[model samples]
Target: MSTAISEAGNIPVNAATPVVTYSPVVFDVPGRAAPLEIKVSAPATGTDLPIILLSHGHGETNFIASLHGNAPMAGFYAAHGFVVVQPTHLDDKALGLRDSGHPEAPMFWRSRVTDMHFILDHLDEIEATVPGLAGRLDRDRIAAVGHSLGGHTTSMLLGSRVDDPEDPQTGDLSDPRIKVGVILASPGVSDEPTDGVMMQRVRMLRFINFDTMTTPALVVAGDKDLNENFSTRLSYRSDAYTHAPAPKTLLTMHGAEHIFGGITGFDTVETTDEDPERVATLRAMIWAYLRSALYPDDKAWPAAVEALESGAATSSGTVESK
Candidate 1:
């Protein structure tokens, strides 16, 4: 009921800009093997709007990127007037090393990295499909968002600094146009590729033995998460506040689940916690960080957080998590 009411509304990517959705197009990013399912929608009015591309975690393992199915987050952002892209990584089902051959799939852990770069190369995705869409995406002001495995991608895009940003490295993170920071939730292991898990991404950020990072960042995870340690470390957690050479923020959800507050694709009411109050708090933190980093000078964000603490964020009728 609440989703019906709220989802019916529209988010202004620009001032009173009429938002529109183009017919869906399915394609894969170059260099990867799998064919990605992508659909873009944005404001029709000609104005420069920020672009936010999303990469879902291993769908079979975590159910992060299901399209036209039960659980999905790409639509949420696209509906908010963003040019959203969802890469269909069929190789994840095999559960082996990163699909180095997949077009959109990152080689090794840098799959998230390639996803961002490929989207930048094909900026006309929205325009080619949807008319009058060029002005909506200000390529210079772009951001990346990922969940679980995808969350790791978010870190690669926005963290302090990569050891050699210009080394012509080719893997999951060989992009050259990542400008803004990142938003990562329930991130997986990202320690230097020493004895860490084989699935872990090889992080280039300074904290991992490099010098320092130049990009701002934010990390969010549930204390009850399954991969809390990896998530925390990647997000820059320390006993004391260790400000990033670039700005950074880290958050932990006390009673939340391993999946960063259980924002499922079903009904919001069906989420692990029917208690929207707390769940909304987590969501507010993420959305606010995105707004501040991507859409600066937006005051309503803080107020939205306050309201979401017990209002819309938690308004979902789902029961509280155990």
Candidate 2:
């Protein structure tokens, strides 16, 4: 392992400023079945810290699918100079909305996008909720990151749109506030289940259009993330990178699975491929990508890529860009 890519890729972790986390910062949204809940994590001391809006996946685990999930990712980003905020979308398993007869039951795709916008709209309030965090965030340099279904949410925030048949108002839901994004193990543009089980299962996925996803992003997929419940196509998850326009990067992790080495939570049963080292390196890569994307002059992305290619970071993955 090379010290070239410090603990957090190009950004070295400072032992002086420890990580701090606060949770359940509630917000009442009209028309929403339940109040919105969020968790925030950041360094104890930092000014003008960049922001990362982390969206959790709709996983099998109860708490990991909500604001309490992705501790590995949120901790890494926060420890390495980024203020991370996570929202518990309406589809959270703990909410039990799947059988509520709501039109967007199960996935609640549109509300997921709305939650991100609501977070951005009320950053001031969110900041005040956490002690010593007010006026320390760089509002202009915010990025969105999502895993699995949350990946679709991040893509939507980055410009991906859905032409939903059930919802005629499903127009462009892209937000200019999000400068860049990371999509991990998310569904791709596929017609494999044209009229099959998946079409009737996750119907919204059938209409996901990446033609207009023009924002810059990094799409990550595992070589072994084959879930029979979804499409069996090996390239199904990486299609977001394949179909999206230029200014995108794809990171294919060797031997990794849907959880990308246990990103949802530490030692959780949801992660079939539970390798801590893989999780650490993946965190570094994501941190580097977000840093470089937010600051064009930053050399973190290229340095991290070089480290990975040179076997300094690890031999577990390969990176390609358009």
Candidate 3:
């Protein structure tokens, strides 16, 4: 595949080679009361294809935070030869777990990580459920991609650990099976919680630690995403990239915001920046990053970085690596 980013920010999708999608693929979790539901999308043809476990961001909208959202990104990845699997976490508004008093209520951070792990463990069953998808997935090459709160989930799978103040010796939940990750608009490290209702709603953000985040990842953040409710500075959103070790990259979108140009859905009201070109740029960059990270010898990542630095891709973003 070429490393060039088209003006429209999309690689041509062959209409004849359509993508197939399956939703609500049920899998029973051993300790969970409800079976896990997922949406699977893949190219009509291809074998041993890489897998992308897409974790949806928690949003005010009921369905956007569930397996039903992010069709634009998922469809793009599927069309580009990746098997994308998105799970509806217990925290999804559609489940109405708020009044149920679910143990992982509120953030449901731990359960979110477990959801991704459960999906990886049941890939065989998931593939079998979809017609013509059997034995087509490259189990060995897997990556996790997430946005916002979902990005926090992706970080844990990639070796990031959260220290429990109450239990100092708590073990890390990092899953070794995930080879790489891409974190978009994820929460940053904070010494203390922000004042007011935002703190009560997202209390878990203050305890995140990036020292143990050893996996190779690409951190994408927006310059104008000054999420005042979460942090005092806009740069706070780039913490995942600034604090992580080498073999990590930071893609700072110049005029972007939390939604990153409507990636959550097509023409959704949540998008503060509605530039389709920006979304396309994000798609192209992510595709290049995943390709090169999965294969050391692949030049797509470096080439794409060069394009960004040289202003060939677009002047709206800048990239840095350590």
Candidate 4:
């Protein structure tokens, strides 16, 4: 190990603090087909705890695509002193809306954006449902972490705009409440011919404009996440960081795949690169990055980077900031 603490405290990369989790926090929203369901996770004891809205990816799996997914990431964030809220977006396969012929059937990109806003707007209600969590939240210190298609949603929430002429809901969907975002294995622009094949296939993706993504965020990309269905270029996933303006950071994993060491869930077959150490490093880096981003004075981000560089954590990847 690098012998460097991730932050001012001697918190190791693999620190596992006790966490409490509550699921199926239901909310009835207007104009929504079904009730909104979410899961909440937080440290057993903490006050003024920051918030992390974890948006799950649109995977082929039956369960991980919904609020029940991303336990590995959500649990870790909660254990490390953050209130993680995960919602079951309308696009989740478990909802069985794929063949319903709804306008946003397959992806529900717009609804995904709205779901996040709803979560923020009702933080008080969300907190009141869970015991010991009612007065422990720090609403001002909020960040978002998303993976895959959920990453695209996070980018949209963090100031990435779309100017689709055919779509009526296409506009500025960014939320000012979300201070920082972590985009993992998200889609990139399709400027080149061979790049972003999936973008053309996905209706909303054809109109994505990353030039307006001014949010301060950390984009995590895997060097080996080359899916021919999406794009032939390895840099496709890092486009959020590449096209975004200053105040951005990119963490390029050395040989990781789209799953990035199985972030979707624990021991799920969807993860092609199943390295537990790599996942631990990823969770640590995410916790540290959000910690520093929400609290600018905190040195957790830099310290974690130094630890990764010095071989303190597993050699999962390299980090760069702009």
TM-score per model over all chains: 0.65, 0.94, 0.92, 0.94
How would you encode candidate 1's per-residue C-alpha lDDT over 1-322 as one tens digit per residue? Answer: 3542333112212233345655446665555555555556565554676666666555443343433321334444444445555554443444343445543343234555565566677778645665667545777767666665565565555542234454465323424365554444433324443333423443333223212334655555554444333443433322111333435555555566534444544443324543334443544444455666676787644554444444345332121111
With candidate 3 superimposed using the best TM-score fit, by how many Å does residue 206's alpha carbon deviate from the native?
A: 1.4
Per-residue lDDT for 1-322 in model 3, tens only?
A: 7465443253222232478999879887888756799999999998989999999988888789989888778988888778999999887888888558776676677888999988888888888898899989998889999999899999988877677676554458888889999999998887544533455566567677888899999999998898767877788778888888777899998889998888898788888888777887787789889988887897877777776667766436888889
Global fold similarity of model 4 (TM-score): 0.94
Q: Check candidate 4 and list the clashing pairs.
A: 1-312, 2-312
Per-residue lDDT of candidate 2, residues 1-322 (tens digit): 6444224433233342588899889999999989999999989997999999999998767788999899988988898899999999999999999779998888998999999999999999999999889999999999999999999999999888898777787889999999999999987765764434665688787888888899999999999987666676888889889999988999998889999888899899988887777787888888889988998998888888887787776436999999
lDDT of 4 at 272: 90
lDDT of 4 by residue, 237-270 (tens): 9999999997899998777999987788889999
For residue 228, model 4's alpha carbon misses the true position, in angstroms, by 1.5
TM-score, structure 3 vs. true: 0.92
Q: Which 10-residue window in model 2 sums to the lowest lDDT? A: 5-14
Question: What lDDT is obtained when candidate 4 is compared to the true structure?
Answer: 0.86
**Comparing 1 and 3 by lDDT, which wins?**
3
Q: Please identify model 3 stretches exceeding 4 Å from their true place.
A: 1-17, 167-170, 192-197
Question: For each candidate, what is the lDDT?
Answer: 0.47, 0.87, 0.82, 0.86
Error of 1 at 10 (Å): 17
TM-score of predicted model 2?
0.94
Candidate 2 regions exceeding 4 Å error are: 1-16, 193-196
User: What number of backbone clashes does candidate 1 have, counting pairs of residues 3 or more apart or in separate chains?
Assistant: 22
